[model samples]
Target: MKKFKIGYRTIKTAVGACIALLIAEYFDLHYFSSAAILTILCIQPTKKKSLNAIYTRIVASLIGMLYAFLALELVGYNPIVLGIMLLVFIPTLVSFKFTDGFISSVVIIMHIYNEANFTVSLLLNELALMAIGFGTALAVNMYMGDLQKDLDQYLKNIEELYRSIFSEIVKYLRNGDTSWDGKEIIEAANLLNKAKSIAFKDVENHLTRKENQFYLYFDMREKQLEIIERVLPKITTLPVMVQQAELVADFMEELANNVHSGNTAKKFRSKLEEVKEEFATMPLPENHEKFLAMASLYQFIEEMDKYLVIKQTFRGIRR
Candidate 1:
């Protein structure tokens, strides 16, 4: 059997619901348990999402009250009237793009329908319920678990994967080693996606923050990884190791050693330019096989240059 553990969201939802119930009961509001339901619905993983849920629920509940009052007063309080009201009310909410609030609104509509009365006092009571429930949810959801430590670990793991990948490429270029299973490439790709997801969640948790530097950093690495994947076959399939391979291998080793969050792409790009210049002075390939190998090596170098250029264009994450 799979093990289950309660997460922070679960804890927050429980605490918020209990608080909503206590406040509602203290006020002696009729149908006070509805406040707990509202709290449960409003609690979300991110503060921004929770706030949006609160807004949608409040607007839709108010609209539902209006619909209930009109249908009950004009058509009389009957089951058919309730059904017809829902038919029109659901479509109206959908048209207004308030679908998220449908369930909570239905709860409010039922309360008014059960009372069979729509008075100013009833409206005030429902408003109070909304305030207590959504307010409690908002208060509880304000404490988002800090993700910075996890993001930093992800960054470190991704950089280590890059180092391993570069080291493997260096081995292949230097002595035609094919022992490596290229697991680091797959691992890095998966880790980058996971990191980006977490970083995006972190962004959502901060209502006023429009951008996340860690997210941008992972995006940059993902682009570089794409280039690396595209060039891997060319590097591994080189027909023979040429003198230029040694130069490329040296550059790869240096890059592997310096795999970090810092902006060192410019320095590497300068070194790459020197390597390209030296390539121009090297003797022509002796045969077709050597020519093919040299061609592949040149393509690999160009791709590496692109990889560095991607980092160069990125506004790196601050430490």
Candidate 2:
């Protein structure tokens, strides 16, 4: 037999379903399958999402039972009464923002017709199933593995891409190097998107009032990359001004070194201001080509300043 590797969430969900079944059997509930079904439905990827699922399902189950009881007592059990009950309750659950519980509520309504009665014992049975299903899901999700390491790895990837991008720009500015085809920008954008998704999931794993710094960090990088994309094309047509290119290349190299450092944002901003001042003091470009080159250099400096400002919003220094 061949073996397959299974994900942690899949394993957790399977365990939760087994636990729910055992608990339902221990309680002598008539519907152990219902508990198992709820466990499967409630086993979400994040603790926060799981908790929300359990809450919504529990509330919807109660509402469903109430409708069942009222229908049995007033209209008496019939296909027409069940239809009316669904017609009334589905919209009610939707209005209360409990749409996620619609299918679970229908299951509860089905149980009433299955047993052909709405007695107190039946109510107790549904409650037991609910308790077993949701409790097992909560227990399984309590152990969220360390996400900080994964988030850090993602940041490191983004930083390396930043280094590549700036290095290419430096090559172009210095000797009009056209070897690089600006592919790094697209790669960095894709990485940033993936990092943001992972960070958002990490936020959902933790139940807290505090913001997820990893998510914020990626978001900041995304904004910086936008500025970089704008600056890349500006360098493509610049006249080779060796002295200016050397300065810009050196500045970019330094900026890449301190990409993940929070303490250096202020320093970088100061250095950029000095560069801008130097451009102001320089003599006017003698030709149209030289003028365009100077204009592109000035704009690049301004964009670098904006990039540093975005980085300043991140919470911590890179490890």
Q: Clashes in each model (backbone N, CA, C under 3 Å)?
A: 0, 0
Which one is best on lDDT? 1
Question: TM-score of predicted model 2?
Answer: 0.94
lDDT tens string, model 1, 41-115? 999999899999999998999999899999986788889999999999999999999999999998888888888
Estimate, for each residue in 28-128, the C-alpha lDDT of model 2 and write its tens digit.
88978888888888888888998899899889988988888888657788888888888999899989999898888778789888888788898888888
How much is the lDDT of residue 250 in candidate 2?
Answer: 84
- What overall lDDT, based on C-alpha atoms, would model 2 receive against the true structure? 0.82
The 10-residue segment of model 1 with minimum total lDDT is 310-319
TM per model? 0.98, 0.94
